[model samples]
Every structure is written in structure tokens, then in C-alpha cells.
Target: MAVSFHVRSSSYPSRQHPQAAHVDEQLTRLRSSETASSSSIRQRLSNLQDLHDSLEKMIRLSVTNHALSQDQIEKVLDGSIKILDLCNVAKDALSQMKEGLMEIQSILRRKRGDISAEVKKYLASRKFLKKSFQKVLKSLKTSQNKNNNDALAVFGEAETVTIALFETLFSFMSGSKACGKWSLVSKMMSQSKVTCETDANEFTRVDMEFQSEKSLQMEDVQNLESCIQDLEDGIGSLSKSLIKYRVSILNI
Candidate 1:
């Protein structure tokens, strides 16, 4: 995504325009989901899907062209595509996690030898996925100083919050906060119990249990399998809305 461009003064930052106000209202609702849980993220994505539907209406109206410049449209389009890619990565992570979780469950069913090896494998994949998210996030952040995620394009109010939401979504998915070299996911796995109330997302629960359990419990694996399935469904919904929104942008 492109960095922050020169702020076009005519672009209304007050969000007085009805579409802008509507977007703000929807974003406010999404923001209310303060927890970093899978359910919270899913709610935000679903809400954003509705918000994009409104954006689609805006795109079809003649006023949308007046609201955003040709350059701003291109910027939002570029950033939107990147957000789509980010969503795809999240979906892939969920799929892989689901696959790994099923493998462990199979072993549990068979009453096989050391489940630790399988647990280790799952954790390794988590670490790898975390790093993948970080690499993409770093690329997104480079644009933030000038235009992206945190400080998205100034003439791009319609998409500013939209981009920010995707940033938040991915950040939570990756458990991106760091303790030295380790991500929050890695840090949580090292500890025995889930002491932190806010860090009690589905993935974290799974990680903590895998580390603390003497023998990997079938119940926890089952719970994580459900979590993966839920996330996959959420990503599918979000991706659908995003593609429609992208098409709307093109039509304008």
C-alpha cells in the first residue's frame, strides 16, 4: 500500500458527508468489540461487511466521485487490495491450524506415542505463521508513516477506518505484541495457565493448554478445531464483501 500522501485540504475530515457519517457509525460499532478474541474479531469483520455494503451504495451514486478524487480512488483501491491479501493470509493460517489440530486429534484417538512431538509441530507452525504475519505487517507499516494503516491517505476518509480495521484484525490474529523476539502467542505458550484475562482468545487458550497439558487433551483440541472453523467462515464472509467493494470501486 502507498504511504501518506499530501493531505488535500478540500477533503472533509469532519466526516460530515452522510456516507462518511454512516461509515463512522459502523466503525464505532466495530470498535466497541475491544477484546482480542476470535469472536470479537469475527463480529468486527461481519459489521465491516455491512459497512462495505453501504460503501457499495455510495459507489453507485454520482456523489461518490465528487467525494473522492481520481488519485484517492486509486490509493484506496491499492490499499483495499492489500487488505484483501491480508484476509487471505488469515484464512490460510486458520486452514493450516485446523489441519494441524486434526492431526493431533487423530493421534489422541489412536492413543499413540508421545503427543509432545505433535504439539511441538503445531507450535512450530504457529511461530511460522506469526512471523509471516509480522513480515506482511512490516510492509504495511512502512506505508503508514506516509499513507497506510495507522496513517492512511489523508484524502481517503472513506477508506481510512476501513484500512485501520483490517490492520487491527490482522494484529490480533498474529498476536503481534512482542516480548523481546517472541510474539504474544509464543510468550503465552511458554507459560502454564492463561492468567491474562484479555489474552484469553481461542488460539491462546489452545497454546497455553498444549504447553501445560501432560497429555494433550482431546477437549482442548476439539475446542481449537471449532475456533479454526469459525475463523475460516468469518474470513470467507469478509473476503466476499471485500471483493464486492473492490468491484464497486472499479465500476465508479
Candidate 2:
């Protein structure tokens, strides 16, 4: 009779391999979790970038509106000033004509109607004088009318341009999708900023609420909230600056 000892093959997994297998499983799970978390974070970052882009576009439009308003207002003012100058020029020309006429009358009185040959010669030379006078009169009338028409057109253009800018600003500010006055637009912009901030804060709070309580520390919560607050402040500041720029342009 032979004594037999039973030997088990290591091929059958047992406690010895269980530890290594458990570690591999844990690593796989961790990698999966990290990939999911990274994807979620990437999505959130994309959303934030989109929001930033929208805000920047709004700010750029506001600046454009302000510049257009200022340019139109300046044009209006310059047109008015030019009209004033033209009026003065016309007045001065008329006064000079009157003085020249008076001097001619005085000279005719000295001639006593039976003027000498020298006086006749002077009268013949006066043809050039008469032509110059006619030319001056024609030029003055045409210039004055042209200036007046140009001023009118400029004023009309300014008014149209300003109105367009106002409509654009109002649409952005009010979010009402309707055109309105500047004062109304300003108030709407302020109110809209407040609403956006409140909504952002609410969204952040909700995001926090969705996270597992065990995973989030108080510090993480505070940092996320601070980021929301900063975004709100930045948007509000931009709105205020836009309003101020419009106001200053109107004053000018």
C-alpha cells in the first residue's frame, strides 16, 4: 500500500489570487468613475464657456450702440454750428453790399447828373463791378440754401441713427424683445442682471444639492458659491458700464 498526499492545482483561483484580483477590480472601477467625472466636468466647463461668450457678445453690442449714439449726436451738433456760421456769413455780405451802395450814391451826388468824360470812363469800367456784384449775390444765395439743406439732412440722419441705437440697446437691456426708451432700457438691464444672478446662484445651489453629501466638503461648497458670486458681479458691472456710456453720449 502506498500513502497518497492530495495536491491542489494553483490554477483554481483561491485566497492567494483573490487579493490581486480584488485590487484589479478596484482599479477598474476607479478608472471608470474618474472617466465619468471628467466627462461631467468637461460638460460643465463647456456650458460656462458658452455663457461667457454670450455675455461678451452682449457687452460688445452695448459698446457699439454707445459709440453710434455719440457719433450721431456729434454730427447733429456740428450741423447746427455750421448753419449758424452760414447765417453769419450771409449777414456780413449783405452789410457790405449796403455800405457799397451808400458810397456809390454819394459819388453820384457829386457828379450832378451832367458827369464829365472821366466820370463816363469810370461808369464804363463799372461794368466789371456790376458783374462782380451779381456773381457775389448769386453765390451767397446758393451757398446759404445749400448749407440749410445740408443741415436739415444731417439733423434727420442723426435722429434716425440715434433712434436705431436706442432700439438696439433697449432690446438687449430689457430682454423684452420690444423697443423702448433709454430710461426704461436702463432699468430693465439692471433688473435683468439681478435675475440672471439669482438664477445662476439657484443653479449652483441645486448642483451642490445633487452631489453626494459624503463627497463634498464645506470648503468645496464655499468655493463653488464664490465662483457664482463672481460671475454675477462681473455681469452686473458690465451692465452698469453700458448704461453709463449711453448716458454720457446723450449728454454730449
Candidate 3:
């Protein structure tokens, strides 16, 4: 679900962070980024970083504590926990996929190990991870929070956006759910010239090629390796921002 983090004009006139509107702009861009391609996901992560940076600024103001009750704070904490879990799982998958990619790269480079067997094992591991990620992805719903025009509401909505973004990314990683689930993104896809930088399903392509009469290529392994590195770096940065966010809310 998309959310604007700008403080509402009506809600006790919450203290406004200078970049709150900027955060909303980033949020809009992220919502429109329907494809979880490596480039798009990296862009989304950059937007998330900006949004969270604004959040940290907003957190420092007195209104943050006044707008939130103990119960509401706990709710935010629950969502925060989910965000960390989602982030961690992604990190784990990327790490594993990178390791597997390296193994395949080594096999291609030195003709070490049964290449076909190693390829099969890598594909199988990815398939298993995809199956497991399904459950986690389902929990990241597109929220439609009413009266969500204030910063406190934004805090919760931020969590929703975080979840929804991850849902799209993981969906791409699994290569299962079509973009149609997010109707706006699907609709924009036809008009959008920008798609994934090397689609996450590139691994599936590599696996398919390996299974075919055609032998493995170093180019395939290297391309996927580059994509994974991009994702890993983005996720690591997001993870740090998310942790700081958790700390900010608690201190409030």
C-alpha cells in the first residue's frame, strides 16, 4: 500500500520535517515501480532510504510521542519486527544465491565438479527458497488506512509500504506472481520503457539453458552475479535504515 509521510495540517498541527513532502514523492515513485527488476528494486531501495531518513527527522520532534499511544507504539513495533524479518530473509536469499552463483562460476571457470549436477542443485535450492518466501510475501498487504494523513499514521503506513515493496521484490525473485496483483503497476508496464535491469528470473533462464542441449556460459553466471551484488548492497543499506528506524521509535 502506498502512503504519504507528510504531516497532516489538521492533526494537532504535527511538527513537519522539511523533507516530509520529499518522502511522499519518493513513496509515490516506489508505488509506481511495479517491476521488481534489479534496477527498479535498487531505485525503490534508494527511495526507501530517503523516506526513512525523513522519518528519522520527524521522529526527533515532540509531536512524535504525543501522536502515539503506548498501544499504537506497540503496533508500530510489531510491524517493524515484520520489516526486519522480511529484510533478513531477502538478505539470506541473496547471500545463498550469490554463493551458488560463485560455485557455478568456478565450475565454468575451472571445469571443477559435475557442472550439470551443481546447476541442478542450485536451481533446486532457489526453488525451495521461492516456495518458502510465498508465505512471507502474502503478509505484505497493500494497506488502505483511513484518516492516515498524519505523521503517526505515516509511521504505520511506512511499514505497509515497506512490506508491499518487499512483496513485489520477492514476487519477482520467485518469478511466480504476475505484476497484475498490483493493478496500477501492471497497467503502467506497457507504457514504461524501463523494466528490470536483468530480470530476477534470469536465474531461471540460466537454469533452462543449462538443461538444454546448450552448455553453460560464463556470461550468464557473471551477469547474475552482478545483479545479486546490486541487490545485496541495496538490501544491506535498507537493513541499516530499518534498524535505526526501530531505535528511533523506541526512544520516542
Candidate 4:
């Protein structure tokens, strides 16, 4: 006779283990938080890029219009000041982006003790972007400082030239008795030639400096553009890494 056999199912949960469920819930929250943070960062970066583009256009226009009218100069200066304010805003936004990434990284490390390779990759890209952003900021600051110094030098030189011209005109109008003295006239003519030559040399130097300043500004702009492109690529990579990390966590 064959004996009858009976099997009982285990009391423990199947796929829905409590520990696994907790992990999945945590992963979901992290994904949600990071998604929001990334979106904010992207928006800020876009704003920063737009501001940079506008500032560049302004600089180009101002540089090209060498003979700006007084009103135009005032307008340019005002616009530049406004652009600088916007730059500060962009800088703040960039800082926030960095901080947000760092916070997220820290949280992930604390929770997991060790993050995934994709997360590590994202962090590295973010760090690189931060460095690049700083370089771009420094380049912009240097360009602005140089432009300001060059403007001051040009203004001072123009004032000196104008004063010299007026003084010479006034001397002639006073009808000095020295005008009849050949030695005195010769000395005056010699002094005038020296003054003219000095002024000419100064003017030439100022022109050269202005050209150099323009070239430097152009270089700064180009560097910033390149940096921006790199930063964009880095951001894209970071975003992809974030998505991959989320997917990996879900799979786990």
C-alpha cells in the first residue's frame, strides 16, 4: 500500500519581504527628491546661460561702437551694471546647484554606506562642472576689471589732451611780448613739438592698449563659451547617471 503524503507552505512572506519593501520605498523617495533637484538645477543653468549670452552680445556691441555718444555710453554702462547683477544671480544659482548635488550625494552615502558606480560618476561630473563654472566666473571678472581700467586710462588721457589744447589756445590769445623774441619763440616752438610728440606717443599707446583689451575680452568670451558647452555636456551625463542609478535601485 502507498502511503499518503502532505506538504505545508512556509509562513514567511514570498517576494514582498519587509526589508526589501523598506529598501524599495526608500529608493522611490530618493528618486523623487533627486528628480526635483535636477529639474531645478537645469532651469537655473538655462537662466545662467541666457544671461551670459546677453552679456556677451552687449560687450560685442559696445566694443564695436568705438565712437559711442555720451548717451550711448551711459546706456552701455547701465546695461553692463544690470548684466553684472544678473551674473550675481547666476552665480548664486550655480552655487545652489552644487550644494544640492552635494547634499544628495551625502544623503545617498549615509543611507547606502557606499553608493553605486553611476552615482559616483555623477558626483565626479558635478565636481568637474563646479570647477569649470568657477573658471568661467574668474575669466569674466578679469575681463571686467581690465575693461574698467582701460576705460579709466582712456578718459584720463583724453582729459589731458583736451587741457593741453586749451592751454595752448589761451597762451596764444594772451598776446605775450615773448612772441616777438626769436629765442623765446624758438624755445616755445621746441617745447610745443616735444609736447605734440609726447601726446602722439601717448595716444598711440592708448590705442594699442585698447586693441589689446578688446582682444582679451574676445578671448574671455570664447573661453566662457567653451566652458559653457562642456558644462552642458557634463550636466547631460550627470542626468543620465541619475536615471541609471534610479533604474538600478528599482531592479534591486
TM-score to true structure, per model = 0.73, 0.22, 0.81, 0.23
Report the alpha-carbon TM-score of model 2 versus the true structure. Answer: 0.22
**Model 3 spans > 4 angstroms off:** 1-17, 141-143, 147-149, 180-201
* Model 2 clash number: 0
Q: Which ten residues in a row are the worst by lDDT in model 3?
A: 180-189
Model 4's lDDT to the true fold? 0.32
What tens digits encode model 4's per-residue C-alpha lDDT throughout 1-252?
A: 011112235984334323323333432222122111223334433433332333223223333234345554554444334333433434443344444345434654476543344334434544554465445434332111123333232322222221222222222112121121112222322323221111222112322333343322323333323433444443444334324432332222
- Descending-TM-score candidate ranking: 3, 1, 4, 2
Off by over 4 Å in 1: 1-21, 142-171, 174-197
Task: Using TM-score, give the best candidate's number.
Answer: 3
In model 1, the Cα lDDT at residue 189 comes to: 24
lDDT tens string, model 1, 1-252?
A: 221212334764522446545655765564343445566666766786787777666566565555566766787688678778877887888888898888888887888866788889988998898788778756653222243332223224434444555555556555544222212222222323222224455576678787785655567678768867876887788788879988988877
**Between prediction 1 and prediction 3, which has the larger lDDT?**
3
lDDT of 3 by residue, 1-252 (tens): 323233567656755455656566666676566565657677887788777777777676675667677777787778878888888999999899889888878877896778777778888888889887887766555444454546556776576667767866777677553452344333332334434433336555666676683866677778778877888888888888878887998998
lDDT of each: 0.62, 0.32, 0.69, 0.32
Model 2, residue 97: what's the lDDT?
34
For model 4, the superposed segments whose C-alpha errors exceed 4 Å read 1-66, 112-252
Task: Estimate, for each residue in 1-252, the C-alpha lDDT of model 2 and write its tens digit.
Answer: 000112237686323233223323432222122111212223322332332233223223333234345445565444434333432332343243334333434554575543233334433333444454344433321111122332133233222222222232212221222222222223322323211111223223323333333332334434443443443333344334334433443554
Position 234, candidate 3: lDDT: 85
Top lDDT hit: 3
Candidate 1 scores a C-alpha RMSD against the true structure in Å of 8.3
